[model samples]
Target chain A: MRVDVRALGACNRLAERGAERAADALADLTGTDLAVEVTGASVASGEDLAEAFAGRESIGVSVGLDGGLDGEAVLAFDSQQADALLSLLPGGASMGRSAVTEVGNIALGGFLDGWANYLGQAIDMTPPRYFEADGAAVLPDGALAGDGVFLFESRLDATTTDLDFSIYMLPDSGPFRDLVVGKTATAATPGAEGAAEGTGDAGSTVVPYESLSTFASLAKRGSTNAADNIGMMTGLDTTVEVSRLRFVPLADVPAEVGVEPHAGTVFELQGEPSGYLAILFEEESAAAVAASMLPTEPDDPLGDMAENALCELGNVMTSGFIDGWANVLGTSIAHSPPEFVHDIGSATISPIVAELGRRQDYGFVIDAAIQTEGVQAQCDVYALPDERELAAALSRLSET
Target chain B: MSHPSSAGGRDASGSARRVAVGVGDLAVVDGDAALTTSGLGSCVAVALVDPTTGARGLLHAMLPSADDSQSSRPSARPAKYVDSGVDALIDELGAAGASPNRLEARLVGGAEMLDLTAAVGPRNVERAERALADAGIPIVARDVGDGVGRTVRYRPNGELAVRAADGFERTL
Candidate 1:
């Protein structure tokens, strides 16, 4: 075969959430669930190859019959898609074909397996073909003469990686079973054209992730237990972990955010840029947790169980930031807390919020991940910069 | 990744022009056109355009080539990996009137998303640059293989500027 060489990489990224995201993106794009096939590929260059330079890469691919989906085809992406897949990688403007190769070797394997199983077919695939060019050129020019095509494209908002896949197939599928059948198969059948595409969080993803600020005046009593109160209001399981919640001067935090909590009964800490948390459990855990907390009956949309957990989680966590902050600033300010957002891209949680609150003179931001019994939750809290109070606090923050 | 910000706040002229790339994203600019992208970290970015057509192309890659033992799974999207993704970008540029022999190449990205544990970044950079070179396309300039992430931009004529950034930015 006339293979065009681009870059090469081993499947070292096949671990933890890195592996899961690859699997999920694959399933979301190809309509099939995937499992990891542990294998390794080593590289030749280390000294010159150690850095993020051009003209070098290392990633691998292997094919097998998970015997599930009807048809399976992998479409390796360029860095453009890699840009979309990794939360930290930026847009396509900077990367090369190598990044896409890694995405292809590691992430594409999961997607292919997922789609093959989704189609309920024993999928036999060729060894991967790597090169330097746009992916569309290698479309089954001759092989797809009779097969219809299922072009699935997915994006990872965090990595800016693109998991774009196209399966050349016959319109009708002869089932062989072994797919994700049972319940999820029926639900995930994306009945439409063959353009099977969507991030794992595509469904119900339109839930607006707007960054908002609500103002609340401190109550007369100091021990209002507002953070815990938010837990009650939202009805879910949550915790308030504080490394150092002591009352201190306002100048401790970064100056870019102008808000000096010391002026308002709130202290601050060393938050570099932003931070995050992970949220995941399952439905049973959610029900148990909800049963113990929510005053209302916990019988709603099964999916909402996680949402409930997340809302309270958001409320409680932000309340922690508020409580700790209030002590630092030495003022009692009320809070209009953050709403919980579920099925979110864990990587983009901060970027989305930072994108929104970048210009605002906010006091603090608490990025939280509420793991429910089943569904995942990503919630964040942006301390609305109190303008009048902050004007006074800046002078204090600046004075050594 | 470099180029901490994808869309830089408007310059005094309010004209958005520069070589800033996003992850898994691309920009097509005419010969006289200008484009910019965010930097890349471990991800590898490939840029190839026809000087005659001014058809600019850029692809950020993550792994190496699609044919390597590391990339034997044929069910992957070709554009999703360095091996295949670079192919996808080359195909795109070719369609835009870029002759394979006439295509110029530049690379960025492939940062160490993790610490010093793998060769994904280097592999990506090496594969893409080598492939284009093997095809007789010259890589005029490149900024690849930095432990930190980068943001890169490219002018259709292959004028690129890159910035390095730490921390992270969610995909756009």
Candidate 2:
């Protein structure tokens, strides 16, 4: 369900007021000059929540809501930013848990209190739960069990300490949408015009899911190319079993693929319509693939030769993925030299997810799962388009 | 091997009931039953059992404490936070005919899992330990720390079996 522009604007104002109060509370508590800015707001899904925190490691403090509202209010800060905030407290470095807990209690509590006061409703908030992990780990299971979430994301700048922090409010979309739309439905017709005017200059537009099929088809073409290349390189009969372009919650990517450590190649997209491309193989599958690459050294421990083979494999595979996208969208996209990382799938992809999440609510993932005959080996190829570029590409397609 | 009234037939043995405690959840089971909590990454699951009575309770707490401004607000889910969750589990176990004096606690989970800099596992373990100590409940055994998620199963015989993601099973 699409959130009307009027509802988004109202929530934005509500969130801005909340952020101001939270900033004041933080300043009073820490004895520092703090400025809070409501950077942007959106109606996001559970997947969006996951995507927002994708590969970045942070401290997340979530307080659940009860009574009139049902959802969560989350305040997240990067580890460095958290330390910066903590260092400002009395003996903050040593005080750790209690200090962080108190900060979350005040800041997020104030934000929720603002919403409650504005709605003229009594909302009971649960005590904050502290999680120190990537976004997916911090979010509880079933967070996306509902339709979506209303996100009011803000930036808190501690002027005295030069620290910047992020705060997010994820209210249950059903209740939040009802509350905002109910209040503005009568005046929203005219406000819609105003919203169009406001958004016109920003040039930010939501690309519908149907249009993303264009990217999906391009991804399939790339995967087919990758399969053919794999067959030629390893003499293994490879088939692309699953290929699709879909919007997934950033946090859910690692979980989608098992969280186990996987040997993979990471490549950055450069030039026009840039993003990231990852070629990951499950541990056993990677070992098998690496072994298959060099028949002479079958017992190798995926050393330099195996890594180089994987990188070459990645280079060929990514060319297949990106070239198709560029051909379809009529944009030139260049990929950097492949960098190999053998780490947990989540840790490996978190940074890319975090970057994309920061720009947009939903992360568009072009995924192709390939299976090789006679070997229990499978490879996953991911093509992540930069949010803005994908939007622009889709806008161009619409225009054409 | 099946009772006519046995719905779903998941309980073919018909002797033991399996109680699943989800994240931010708590449960007390007595008689022939088992308490289980799965996919515990950075959360701690505290299992309290009376060996003599076979009365048990499990709590899967996410956060360290509940000393926030909203702690005074009624209707808060006690199992969601460590401090209150431990207390609530003890109270529930007591109500389930488990004596507080004879109650022995076993802690499982609280693993870092991911390679993030912020280590919540140790902190969660510490908070649960502290809460148990404050409540005067002696911790008999624990399988905590390490960077791996765990699935804990507490049987009626007071055997707490902890399994890692790699299929390694250890009984505490």
Candidate 3:
């Protein structure tokens, strides 16, 4: 729809001022010099909104808006920045969840309070709900379910802590447009009207985020099982940290994975919800893991024995991961034996992504980091669910 | 799967300029300049060069057609879709003093980078091929498919180099 640029600009300024006040509140709370500025404000569809966060992991806090408006307000931080912020608070490094939530509450509360003052209306806000997931998963359900949304975004850059975060407000387009432009409901923008015309199409069906979360939890269980299996095999204390599932643009995959050459094992899941998985390790990490898998320390770690060990490790890991999906979904999930490749990390995964890209614009990526105690080895496990299979799996979840 | 040939590095003589063509964008250049675009997964890069005049143009188009509602809008960017983008590129190349009859095309990218089951890459390739055929531009060589993301560099001298994510580079 044709957004009134002047009205958008005014709203942007108001949001920026509100964020500045929030920055003051944060500075007083943390005793740090912080700056919050309006970075971007626009109107976009759900797909385009997802594209803005393609391949990124974020932690967000969303609060429902009630008085004088109908929408959601979200404040998000990149995973790295969130970690940095977490480490700044007292007992934060060890117990970050509560502290992070507290921070989100204060920051977003102050922002909404200031905005209410600016608009001369009492804006009632619900308690903030903390979400640590990929960008796509964390987007408010209202935005995804609607044809288009009004996005007002701001960035918080903390100088002392060196942490950068973003705050977003997504308002239902109809009311937001009226509020911003002071226009009546009858004067709908032509663009919005056109977008509304295709309301009942198959493509517009909303895939509930709750169903996706079910799959995410299954992925977490799989990672944990894989971690246990690895620990048993290598006799090393291993732990898996599974990140939230994210929808990533196919073109941005290489950069997202750190485009260096890595040794990888590729596996294809064959079943109702079929997909591909790639486990990647940096050269040094591969050598370290391979060395640990060996019965005795090898003179040369890059030998066939090491490669075989890696392959076996891949097989065990894939089984642990996929078996969890099959069990939870009540379906059979078969997987191909791992195929090893030593090349640029992106190149190894590109073909798999290409296979998916042939059909869809975006692919789902679930990243699991495998860490072993006292070993300088780290393995990244990536799970890409086939689009059709993903849909089927989600539908089954909703049905059950 | 052939070993990558040495093909992508720019000339060190400091004479050639490098121009990057972003997604949904096109550019035409002459002389020692090289036009490049990266992160091409499922999107096709149509590079046109006139051998006689040393003029080259690169169009990075994301979708197959401009028949969508968005494109129907007057504010739509022409270079975003294959149908209109290819035509725009040809017009721009002609504006740059290149003869449309003498233009030779090289297609890169349109690789399926995700297992989405739709075959967007092949469709993109097909659309581009159809558009170029309609425009009467002959495609000399192409590295269009097989599920690998590629970065393409097109020189005015008709040297079209494509480098896959594996660091495998080949001149087509």
Highest lDDT, which number? 3
For model 2, report DockQ: 0.01
Per-residue lDDT for B123 in model 3? 78
* Ranking, lDDT, top scorer first: 3, 2, 1
Report how far residue B18 has shifted in candidate 3, in Å. Answer: 5.1
Per-prediction DockQ comes to 0.01, 0.01, 0.10
Tell me the chain A TM-score of model 2: 0.49
* Per-model TM against the reference: 0.33, 0.43, 0.57
* Deviation (Å) of A274 in candidate 1: 25
- How would you encode candidate 3's per-residue C-alpha lDDT over A220-261 as one tens digit per residue? 678778888888877789877664444444433554555465
Better of 2 and 3 by DockQ: 3
Give the alpha carbon lDDT tens digit for every residue of A1-400 in model 1. 0000000010111111233456566545434434322211111111211221233332223232233443433443343434444433333425544444544655656545554443455455445555533333333232223221212222222222223332222111123111111222223333311112122222311111110001111111111353455456655434432111111111111111111110001112122212222222233433444454555656663346546554464345445554544554454544343333221121112222222112221133222233333334332222324232433332332233
What fraction of the true interface does each of the listed models get right, in terms of native contacts kept? 0.00, 0.00, 0.09
Select the stronger candidate by TM-score from 1 and 3: 3
